[model samples]
Target: MRYDNFPDHSAALPEVTSTWSYHRRSSRRGAEEINDESAVSSEGEKEFLKVKKRKHKKIRATSQENHHWWYAFAVVTLLAVATRQVGLDLPAGTVWDEVHFGTFANHYINRTFYHDVHPPLGKMMVAGAAWLTGYQATFEFAVGKDYTPDINFVGMRGVSL
Candidate 1:
């Protein structure tokens, strides 16, 4: 049932006739308003609203930023190499537990069976270093004993670094 003489309040209140249409309360006027710009045709058909598109900004790194990264990398690499190489062979006969590792290396070089609590990779590396330096497994590697001139202790220790 449609009222032919319905109150002409369309200007003050929006005519909500479709389920798809909705109202939003305006902050300035404190009144409900239709957000979508919709229009009704003479046959009572509603037009679809147009959506706004958004724009995005692209970012790129400058040459100075890349140069700063390279400078930091070079400084770190120099410090690492310098720290490892400084005083690597100073008054070193058997520093710390080198006597045990040296004996293990000798065992590997002499092809003899010896048991160690640690893994064999480190001992094998030391043995390879000693073999490359022409070590004959002659030194006893006793604790606190000075390394002889015949032994290339620096080369053997270099394997660790």
Candidate 2:
């Protein structure tokens, strides 16, 4: 029976005779019921929960991977510092090109102009470090010569580190 002639309160009664006639009486309410039945079904609810758990697991794994990278970076930084700092002042004498650079640094301290193929910035830094360490530029810095007691050679090499 057509429910258009009945009052709105009458539509809420369970007197609806056929599925098609009941749906036509209240189309919006009928659609809501259909949707609720499908979504709240046991199988459908279980599948929804499974998908949510998978998404949460994937997000947790991604966060753990990010932490792994941070740990790796920290380890590498510590190793690099340890390798550079160990035996920094060993042998107690000039090694390699220190003979030439040390002479340039001495010239800078003594205010005497000297010619060298290298750029002046590096020589100036060494000179500044030597000055800060109270080195008097008295040592000749000759190859294979042992460092004097007052040269502050460790402080100068620390600048390179």
Candidate 3:
């Protein structure tokens, strides 16, 4: 049945509860949740509210823990880099595979024509690094040979890393 008058409609509607207004205020103000509401009559509702509050607190705690993990990861990464740098240019010599690849890099710097079974991109990058380090590309990079102290092989190694 439809009510024609406003008074009849208003009288039929249930009274607004304090719980609803309290929740609204809590949402707006981030205030402490009110548990002493007379409107919450069911035990199940109170338990559900308690669970929800706990969930919110847990989410905040998890985010803080996640942030700490991110910082830990960063520190570990930095330590890894530092340790790797300790012996980055150790042995001071033409290491494994440098014979072929380093020759290719020298060829690129000298603009000399050479044939290789592999792609030339990695060699080109090494040659670019050599240019940055003022390497003359004239130094012979023989296999199983130690690099002389004069060459800036470390710079090339840095670029390779």
Candidate 4:
């Protein structure tokens, strides 16, 4: 009875025997046998197919429910992105050193200013972004590319609202 003595060879037929297994064996064509003593399995193949399709299946929430969840998620994400961007943008124009540093950085890049009181790291960070986002960084920060400088207060409050 042990598989160690003889390999299961339904293939070779040299060691084939009349012995059979309790589990159903698929035919050479791979179709399973109809195990209906009441002649029901042969009656409706479509009925068997419908039952078989549902046998190992799981149910998920409908697309409408999923859509609601995703819609809420998208709204929340956009709100967060808008709020953070507005927070960074609320105070338009350069502050104290920023004005001088930004001007100095612009000049420095174009070979304009030397001799600094502080590090160029902060200026460099801002300058790098300005260079990337196109001209007009002298007014609004380079970070806000799509923003309107004229509607500063309204644009800022729009994101919060």
lDDT score at residue 94, model 2, on the 0-100 scale = 90
In terms of lDDT, which candidate is stronger, 1 or 2? Answer: 2
Report the candidate with higher TM-score, 1 versus 3: 1
Please, what are the lDDT tens digits per residue for candidate 3 over residues 10-91? 6778855444555675688667665564546666657656766777774346666769988999999999878767776777
Better of 3 and 4 by lDDT: 3
Checking candidate 2 for backbone clashes, the offending pairs are none
Model 1: per-residue lDDT, tens digit, 43-97?
3322322221112234668988879989999999999977877776886668876
Q: What are the models' TM-scores? A: 0.55, 0.51, 0.53, 0.31
Cα lDDT for residue 72, model 1?
93
Candidate 4 segments whose C-alpha is farther than 4 A from its true place: 1-84, 136-161
Question: Candidate 4's residue-wise lDDT over 8-49, tens digit each?
Answer: 767866532111321234233676644443433232543554
Worst 10 residues of 2 by lDDT: 32-41
User: What is the C-alpha local distance difference test score of each model?
Assistant: 0.72, 0.75, 0.75, 0.51
Listed per model in order, the count of residue pairs whose N, CA or C atoms clash below 3 Å is: 0, 0, 1, 1
RMSD for each model, in Å, please? 14.2, 14.3, 7.9, 11.5
Provide the global lDDT of candidate 4 against the true structure: 0.51
Model 2 regions lying over 4 Å from their true place: 1-75
Candidate 3 regions exceeding 4 Å error are 1-66
What local lDDT score does residue 78 receive in model 3, on the 0 to 100 scale? 97
